[model samples]
Target: MSRIRPQVRISRRLSTTAGVAVTTATLLTAALSPAAHADTRPSRATAIENAAAALLAHAASLGLTSAENTSVRDVIVDKDGTQHVRYDRTYHQLPVLGGDFVVHLAPDGAYRSADRSTRAPISLASIVPKIASPEAAGLAVNALRAANLGTVLKQVKAKPELIVDALHGTPRLAWRTNAVGLDSLGNPVARTVLTDARTGAQIDAWDSIETAAGDGKSLYSGTVPLQTTPSGSSYQLKDPTRGNTYTGDAQGQTDACILSICISRAPAVLFTDADNHWGSGTTADRASAAVDAQYGTDETWDYYKNVQGRNGIGGDGKGSYNRVHYGSNYNNAFWDDSCFCMTYGDGDGTTFGPLVALDVAGHEMTHGVTSKTAALTYSGESGGLNEATSDVLGTLVEWYANNPSDPGDYLIGEKIVKPGFGHTALRYMDKPSKDGSSADYWSSSVGNLDVHYSSGVANHFAYLLAEGSGPKTINGVSYDSPTYNGSTITGIGRDKLGKIWYRALTVYMTSSTNYKGARTATLNAAKDLYGAGSTEYDTVAAAWSAVNVN
Candidate 1:
């Protein structure tokens, strides 16, 4: 999202902490450093230090006690000197898992408010663990094995880290372990398991690899221009203009990783051609699929940079590489934060093609964006919102590209799913229930559904916010959106909708934000974009209500 400053007023009493002073001079120095020169801005290091200092100065006001410490995770500064500082906390030197939060500051460095992952206070009867680390590792490994039942795992390994488990319930000592191994297909699979330190019981376990299912044709956008780097004599499939983001052939291999360490990573063999002209429009040529992958990356990069003012997926001006032709007839694509890259699969011809469609690329890349920003927990309502965020922005990326061959539409993965798949599209944002599994509106039982299907509520809301309810046709695609309440909403346009949602995701939403929290975040975002009671703000409320979010 763009670093747009909002004139928001948050009223809260600041807790007093003696011997700590955040002077105006310090704030001015940090804020003005970015504009020290007309052509230059503050370095990343400088910004981070400044943000850390700012947060530490007001630790007490943020509900941080003397036993707690804060470390800066991210810093976002607006042109008007407004600041959003993200932080990860620790208690008595132990890492706090759900202790992350964001502190908002006005232009003058005045405290606005703080959004925390949890409101529960951090305390422990004892820091000592009844369960040993090695035992925890074994439990984690067993959990991983159970997840991959009926498969023989190779090179299995597990590493455990002691942490305070604030995310799952009351804060308590816990062991967070990452288990990695090669699956039956020789594909690398990893899962993170959380086990109670005192009790041997498993608290939670999730696959570390984030994934979305779909496929697409080779050169799905037809012939498109590419930006490649000249390596020695031939041009390599690397775009230096976009942080040297290169597309590589995985040679049907997957990377085995544990946390940030990869034991055996598939070679990202760079694609080099004698001439820069990369691909023909057929799957017979490997470069054809590579072309679609690279083009999708380019368009996604441009969409965020040009449309949202985000420098990159991480908002750090660094490009992420893409790996295509990833396994034999693999029917899925995924984003690996551990590898910081995108991996696409070659789908079975009958059901899917190459899985490198523009929208698919956009969708997968957006997962990285969400990780860098809100880092929404990938379960329940937050997980649904996470998926919806990708779908919403991915669709916007398609429209931003405006490629005639693959025109913008709300039908996701349409180019990917063939007739054999028995579905017109992976999802229908206009009416998510059309997919036969997705929810049409929010209900108490919505959270019980899989994240992909639960995402329908927000997806439906986004469609109504952009296109409104009732029948409509745009770019030759017909849509009939219904509302929970029989109220018609007049769209304020996709551009405004994007801005509002982006602001909510980056500025207002927290890691644990649910459907209700999402509604609040979007409303706050709308109020920030337009004035409160403005048509845009009212429309945002109306749209959420239409999805039964109210």
Candidate 2:
């Protein structure tokens, strides 16, 4: 149960928005009116092919290619004016998790999951639901195909067993948390800006969440916006400051309910169309894939917000974009240079699966946060600090989300581990020394292991700086973490530790910072948060000495 080979550990793929628009009522059908057909003469099947071909042409310009295209299977124009063209294979691609998807169109104007082998129809009425009345406004699979979309995977592999009906009509928008409500096309938004509906006087403050996404791009979501004048229309826009799940369990993470995120710079807000086409998978799972890639992104934003008084990813009071499920069972998760988005993989029941753990999610996304903030390189000691910064805050988020419903602890990757490999998670903070692979002290060669494992010393130091060197039980287990010089170091709590560490990461540490820099940073951060000669300051100094970090 204690030690296993690194091979089992090596098989895992590791981690890691913006905007607004207020407008008048606009129809969001993407513009659709069935092509005029003189009922007198029945339209030929070639007509269907031509239309589908045209749809693909539109898709080509959207960057869809190779495995992300679609194919038109059949077409049907029922007795009414509805056009339900059956797509034999509707391919999908998740930006984060490289997976695949195949869709089907129901005779009843609904889209369903396609069983490429049996051609069995899986109900789309469940996953995406049937909100678009005419269904004519839906994406033109054939046209998108012509543009850049591709076909179904030749080789099929097992995928997450998704029951579409589970996500049917209800659409699961903000299903768990509040009253403001989520919009129809999967955007969770609420109107907050309110004017007198009279004169545009200086009678009140600007209402509405500070940042908003999707609605700016949902050209098809037709809803009349609120007018500012008192005699005009008064719309209550969500206050980005008010709606965030910041203080408690949410700690910047989304609940099934809080649609209060201030996404300012997200690129794929409205016109974003994900393609879940790894090798063989479904789009839903691909959607799920994004969960791991950006889960901590929220944590990172929150960490900076609460700890550093920053906003969004850039700390510029803006937001960032994230795309998941880029391709099938992707073996890894990475942040790209161009988009600053996270990518992930679906595990093979061993090592690789959902990367939704609070810390893991934060750790990966923090890579970018670190890049933009500290610009820490991925080698030498600064790199170690960069990785540790994520782990430290990731754990902070876990604690911030601490609830009796789902109690929090100082273990990483615990949720994703299974029975084999001792079911042990990644690094342990309570007693970093307990994990044989991690270091209790920064060594000359401490940067030898994977960043995940090598950052243990810093993780250990964080624990000591906050909680102090002690023997205590966290969760169900108990352990005593050691300090290098064997000095009796006084510890604080995770929150205090977080404030100090965060200040250090953002204000002091540079790209080439090493262990010595970490010590100076902690001392400086403590001095900044508390007084220079305060207990917090001295404790930070003692903690560094105790851990031999200096």
Candidate 3:
């Protein structure tokens, strides 16, 4: 989840790409249990109309102009009668980049609050571009080459779209062009170059492709039930039961990426077999890794669906795909948003075994969830928070699975690490500094460190929040968490902690949320769930302070 600003190293891939993919057999074709609600609304259209009218009447409250047209994207009314209405905006008939906003209304149909991607208004100077589209495409291509990226320029498509500048300086008109190609590493790359329409000068550019996804006898998680779809004489890996979660074999190649691999040469073919029984527990069989990836994905899906009330990784009832045995002896795994899929590596046995372990899958899948929700940028303190979120959720998934062979613990990647390393795990939450690189306390220069290491502060904060600041044993593992301050604090329990963190991540936290902002977000979440000034809120504040985030 965290990477240094520029370089794309292998170690960075491991921390940033771990996640789960899920699958099901014919038996799991049942409908998902609908969330229980108390009150009923008149109709979806009526609710949308009511919310839209309210938003239009109070446009200034949301920093919107009267000229902007707002269209309802989706509306969700909670069991408590709270309505969350999401809308897309267009300025003077042109799409606005950061104009999306969500309006929350209380049961009384009164405005509660709103969440906007950008606080700046959308009124720009003009829609006409000073530079032509062809020249803009050339500018984007030149900018890509100027970055010294060890990749070739391929099909570059430049289209002019009117956008308001909110991230950098004052609001201004810009031409946004997206150039799609492949990096030197064979990874699919897309760069959105924002050029000043008045001057044709490049404002900014970022790598469009970012890695971010899950079922079944799973090779590592033991024999498990899977939902499958019948297709003539054979069955497909598709799981009608769990949002059509499917599996595909990369066969150690990138171009064959299915639902979840980025920059694949061709579409991934579903792994079909005469019998639905897939994989023996060894690498000699190709399906074994798919079994592991799918099983882990299923468990993670169930954990979020049953425990946290999330439908899928994106909170929508759509399943992501998984690819196994990707690249020959690849030493790492990753989740790419471009393909909406999860990819696995069969590690060189001497340094690491197969990377499809339960926690590893959970870690990577949670990355997708993070991108959809808080969307913490993969740099600075926010990046650290992104990685920490995966670690926390991944650990929870492991505990939820309750697998006998891989019992739950705060330790990560313990089973996958080779014996030659003498390392018990990749990182420890209770005492993260044990890794020698991770930081256990927040500091002024904390964001300067690698995102994975900087995440230790949040990881340490989570440990103290759930288990307190003292020596303890859990699930056969011993841990003694230290605090930046010498204050003794009591834990609020993992269940409550998980609820608070999930709420903060989904509702309160933003893309650029830092350590201090996180403390406030969790505190706000705790207050919302357990009442203001309650013991839970106090504990959240105390835990954050213990991590030197105050």
Candidate 4:
């Protein structure tokens, strides 16, 4: 859960709590559970929340503590018919900070507990997709970011109305991406739009896809191969002097986050070319994109290869490159295919390094990795995961560095930025609610929360699973996690969790992977690496439930 910053699910018990603490493990123990076929059914967010609340209520009742004895919080399930549960805490004596109980459920519905907590091992990779799946792959595309919509709209230029339609509908991926032109620097420019599944109405807009090839170029040009060689968990950046030292795939100029991609087309940073993303604010300074770019790549690389055993963006032992100093005062960094690199900016001085933080570099790079491997489409449920992946991996990279110059740790983006805007890294995994907004898990009304902050649940869960529940100090940083049922989790090394997650992501997860899918995948992953009925498996399941993934 250590992203550019940290995300954790902590079940902290107050110095006092005499009531409402009855809970038990709800892990389904089936010999060979029913067949799980992936379902292509469109994911309904409303369903996730409803089911979660009902489950919460169910968990609340499981507590052994009597009502007058203590406060209770539990994952309630909506009996109307949704198999979901969530994390909730209640206070019996709010004024005194006493009598508070909480409950958490795992998305897999396999394991759970309340109050009295003990860390048990559980399998990882062997965890399978949720039973909701109707097929082997399940529902895939969930593109719901402003950037992603922009990318889609850019691709379907001929149908502008689809963009509006999507805003009013369930939103589907029924658009085609088309290249348009090239920026002054020669980066490809394109446009896209979404259409109604039935009437083909202008339901949405997808951002464009930028590339080194001309706008007319195909995703895989006949000349340039689509990485003929399989990528993996080890790579060296094309040598610094390889003269591969160019940027702007179109013009081959050296730049980072140059806004050189099809954002004008598919504006989402993930889909756009790195060059096109170079916003002018950060690039305007003499901005040495050099150190920042190299720093990002190296930092990310060490984390994956050394800590997580992941290759490059492709997870096939490939190495991604870095581009620096883009545009006129560019203020941010991003990852893209054309450059396959990370960019940076010179902050307006509110913060020192415009590059944000070393952890951010890993964050953006991991996004590329996530895009290629899990391909968790950027939207709704998966989108939150996608963002969380970036944060988690970014933090892992910092920890991997263990550099005196940087001293990588859980404090994401701290070295590079001190934002006057708000928290340095946009969100906090340790306590999603710390910012005072964002929900930690599925709320029947989760759509109301910002994807960036709303992801706190998953983020916190990951952190707690990695470091254990409760307050502790690491590298001088004091941390505490709020858990369901007011219990505690055990700490597993960040490096180990990173590997399990990486494997689950690149090897097991599919485009349609969701909260439920993530649970199963991680559980399965634990099995693949640690063995069935191992301590790892139990903890993995317990951690998920701790966040109401149940």
Q: Rate the local accuracy (lDDT) of all candidates.
A: 0.78, 0.42, 0.69, 0.45
Cα distance off (Å), candidate 1, residue 281 = 1.8
Error of 4 at 422 (Å): 2.9
Superposed model 3: Cα runs more than 4 Å off: 1-47, 67-76, 87-100, 127-162, 172-219, 230-234, 256-266, 348-351, 419-424, 448-450
* Residues 78-155 of candidate 1: C-alpha lDDT, one tens digit per residue: 656566777667788788887878777766566777888888888798999999999998998899899788889988
Q: Could you list the CA RMSD of all candidates, in the order they appear?
A: 6.4, 26.4, 8.7, 18.6
lDDT of 4 by residue, 20-74 (tens): 3422223111011112565432122333333334333543354322321222222
Tens digits of lDDT, candidate 3, 152-230: 6544444446665554446667777766654444433445678887898887675444332112455566766666777
Taking all chains together, each candidate's TM-score versus the true structure is: 0.89, 0.48, 0.79, 0.55
lDDT of 2 by residue, 1-550 (tens): 1111110001111111011111111111111123366553223243343333333443333223333333332232332323333222222211111111222233333433221212122222223322331221112222222222233311111111111111112112111111122222222222211111122111111111111001111111111111111212321111233122111111112212222322332232211122211111222423233332333455456566665454544444444444433223322334432344443333334554443445555555566555553445454465567667777876776676543322466776665555553536666875675656677777778865545555777888888876777788777656587778878777778889987886565545544466787787688668757879998888888777765676
Identify the candidate with maximal lDDT: 1
Write down the RMSD of candidate 3 (Cα, Å): 8.7
Q: Between candidates 2 and 3, which one is better according to TM-score?
A: 3
Total backbone clashes of model 1?
2
For lDDT, candidate 2 versus 4, the one ahead is: 4
Model 1 TM-score? Answer: 0.89
| TM-score (C-alpha, index-matched) for candidate 4 | 0.55
